[model samples]
Target: MDLIKTEKSIEDTNKTNNQIESIFTSFMENTLFKDKFVLQASYTPETISHREEQIAQIASILAPVLRGERTSNLFVYGKTGTGKTLSVQRVRNELLKRDINSNNLIIEYINCKLKQVSDTEYRIFAELIKKLGGNVPATGLPTGQVYNKFLELIDNEKKLIVIIFDEIDHAVNKITDNFLYNLTRLNTELSKSQISIVGISNNLTFLDEIDPRVRSSLGEEEVVFPPYNALQLQDILNERASRAFMPDVLEEGVISKCSAYAAREHGDARRALDLLRIAGEVAERNGLKKVTLKDIDFANEKIEKDKILEIVTTEPRQFQLVLLSIIDIVEKNERLKDNLSSSIFTGEVYNNYQRLCEKTKNDPLTQRRVSDILSEFDMMGMINSSVISKGRQGRTRQIKLVIPKALVPKVKKILIDAIHLS
Candidate 1:
């Protein structure tokens, strides 16, 4: 019996290997993508469409840098996928090209959304120093020491330094806005060199939230980028689609469907491009020659699931604990197979949350705080919450998980692993 079982296992392994090999062979033989990177976010076209005015404005603002003059600190605000980063990068590249003969101007860019590089003040300074050809120990040095090192490196010569901080608000959230004040004040301490800043944020009201002191020191010239409309999105999609896929690979209306979906997302061109790219992948996987409307729908569902899982992975411990408690309640109720809705009350979730906090040896937040987290989750579409009032008894929220039944197991596993729950 053992010999037969071992033989069967070997057969199954061989079958799996053959299946994988066949999939790879199919990918190589009949792929749809001509150049998939054309649909990627990083690919900068020679001429950016629908952003000419914004690009020209940014260029005019920074044009003084070409003549070794300190330009006004610029603040750029826009929603995601509004071509803010691409326009700024294009202008920066132009400045570099125009000033190639002189080493008097230096420009650097940092993405503050990256956790490892910008979660703390020290790491931000360290990353900047490293970019300027200086190295510091990753840790063990005081933040002030790291700041001094950066100042010394940049002030060693008579040059103008322009540092662009992308997603600057995210950095401020992790650290304080005092760093901005310190950075903007650097010019006063330097005798030969001057420093300028270009802050970019997806938050429309980011500047309003910062310290008034930092705001005054920044002295920023503001630029706002409006979201694209559906027609505009169609134009953008048409250009990228022509380059991203082989001719005749996309079924009719696929681009239109993608544009509509993205327009509903506030004209996010990046999301539209992602949809097109992923739909192509779905088609290729299904061994279909053309990307159809059905493929786009399937890709959308996949992206939604993946986006939720990503949120689960990145949320704070307390947020995860709260979500886990809700998931546990819903799952237990699911097993009972009651005819009623799976929705539970805020009180029940709080109770389960308290147990989880105890099990993990973490302090439990107040019911009010947990409810606030639940409201945030509702905004993120992870759950549906409603207020129900019972006269003098006051009111409570009716909560239900919005995560698809198919994703519950994966969500539970991630929560368990992240919280170290037994």
Candidate 2:
């Protein structure tokens, strides 16, 4: 063996330090390396699993159609992230696995959140007709005609049809269950196909808003999924972690922290998974192989930026602008003695909207139109309103945000950067 050289040892040490620093710098760009391809918060096969009970309930409702038998329409209810959408999709995927399409089975899943833009839920019906290979001729056709075209398409296919409307709350637009009434009419008016509808909603109020007959038809068979318990949430988080991380890389207490946090709040499995995935990303960005419990805790606090961005991306331009104004005005007025009242807030919000337009060179929507945007926020649970006694006005309402006060500044920053950060 050659004799040790002190000068060589120093060179080796410098090289090793450089490699370590390089790894950390790389982590800054790819926070959750393990979850690079995992869709943390989405409704897809890769992101959904372990929903056995809810899946079974959905199966029992849809079994009839798979067996060439007719069944009543089904309505699924639960608070946010109770796996209502995931369960329906799990069942749908299983039904698809049966792969007897030619033997007569058709399934369609639509996000009523998009299709239910107007008072009616006919957009999805038009989509369904296209899926079934029928032309409804989109020349300002009445909803009645669009529905008839849907039936005609299904009749031509001669296959049992299972239509799932995710976010069904959007369909009625506060009172438009006419779609459900006509859908359940298949057993009578549109008898050519065995049509069964599966509706997934986070709002329980939609059920109350529907016509009694439509409610009866929808609830012919119903299932409600409660939020996951701590133990259940742990299992879900652990399972996701296993797929989302390399072996032994996550610290011992990370999943437990994520589970406890989620259970304490809403027991939302989706939220828990999001926190975990975000934490891992954070850890990876820091160039650490192990994700610590502290990392997960930090993720719980920091992930709202991602959620706010998601909301901004999904909304139309004016709605997104209105939301940005709410965040900005609240943040600028954050130091006030009493959080400014809604009236003052609205005026400030309108001004902020105009400034944003000037900055981005985009046109500002009318103030009345902005009020309409507020109505949408109300439905989406992003904000709340309080009815106040305005002397003779007899209880005019004032708007307030329902989002966490802590998230206000962060949301404001994100929206501002989205518009002006070049």
Candidate 3:
């Protein structure tokens, strides 16, 4: 009887294991996504929407390369997710397709925002060398040696090379503008090959801080991408949805809500797609057949929380302290009065920040430095700051937290723990 009972237990375990595997297989087979990657920002669509003028302009500038002529270096500026990178890449793809057999053109694309790739002058040149079919060590080599090797490699090829530097400002902020000068000046040393640069930046004033000579050389033809409106964003989402999701998986008004939310926040198509994707994931997790408006709300909440946590945890110590100061001010004001507003000015924030620094035994930055950090925080969407004039009292920025109110306590706790304050 004991032997029979043990064998029956083994059989039952096997049956349960098989049932779990079958359930997982069924879940995978019935997912709403036909091709989920089509919704990702990195996945460039075969056709771009609402960027015809910019595409034509970029194509015209790069068209000269097909005829073996050196085109002018181009600069493109726009807010994040305005399709600058996509448009430029699309044009490059077309150029490659046209020159499939000619072997007369070489396109090197590097995003400076990526670490260890385009973070410094050495890394940028090293990447360029490797992309040109030459190998260079990641580090420990003299900068001049890297430049010489890159120059030699390019001079050996009689092809037209176009280098696109996406997020050029990140590297420029970390290092000097000498890399730009070096790239612009490479043409003078090359005998057979010609190099043209396409620089893409989201910062409109990025050129103002760079060396004048570098700016003049790199901005021969500049293109600006305007932010997309609600209608444009909706169209983009609809096109992507048609490819990414199974039919009728998304309920009506889901796309519209995503588009409207992103359109209100500078018309970011990337954010809209992220919202839709996350909402679909939420629906799938809840075993819902269709993504609904409530799922979008949940997705927005999740995205905001994740973004806040990421920024707070990864940002510099000083930035974390500044954010903490804002949270403290808002919480204190709310506790003190039922109707008091929590909005504060730069001067007030700096004062509170200095106090926090002193209490923590850290050296405080000057008010000017704090102001600059505030501007960066504003750009990151952690805070909203508007310049307001006080007539004869001069101008100052009115600052308010953009972080979700529900997430404030969590942010406060994280900041407190990070600073090691009791």
Best candidate, lDDT: 1
The TM-score values for the models, in the order shown, are 0.89, 0.71, 0.82
Candidate number of the best TM-score: 1
In model 3, how large is the Cα lDDT of residue 365? 89
Model 2 segments beyond 4 Å from truth? 1-39, 42-50, 99-102, 115-120, 136-139, 306-422
Error in Å for residue 326 of model 3: 4.6
Instruction: List where candidate 3 sits over 4 angstroms from the true fold.
Output: 1-30, 325-402
Worst 10 residues of 3 by lDDT: 338-347
Where does candidate 3 clash, by residue pair?
none
Candidate 2's error at 232, in angstroms? 0.8
Cα lDDT of model 3 by residue, 1-422, tens digit: 55655777989979999988876875787688888899887798989999999999999989998888999999999999899999999999999989888888999899999996779899988998888789998889999998898888888769799999999999899877887898899888889999999999999999988999999999999999999999999999999999999999999999999999999879988999999999998888666789999999999889889988999988888888888888888877788883355578888788899999999877888888999999999999999999999798778998889998888888888888988752
lDDT tens digits by residue: candidate 2, 1-422:
56675998879879989988887778655444555445266535454455677778778878877678776789999888778887788788878788555568888887777633333555667777777777765548887778777667778746777888888887777435666787777757655677778888888777887789988887888888888888888887777777677778878888888888888777888788788777877787677778998898789768765665578666776677788877666655665645544243455667888887877878888988876778778787777755467686454446677777777666666666666643
Model 3 residue 175 CA deviation in Å: 3.5
Ranking by TM-score: 1, 3, 2
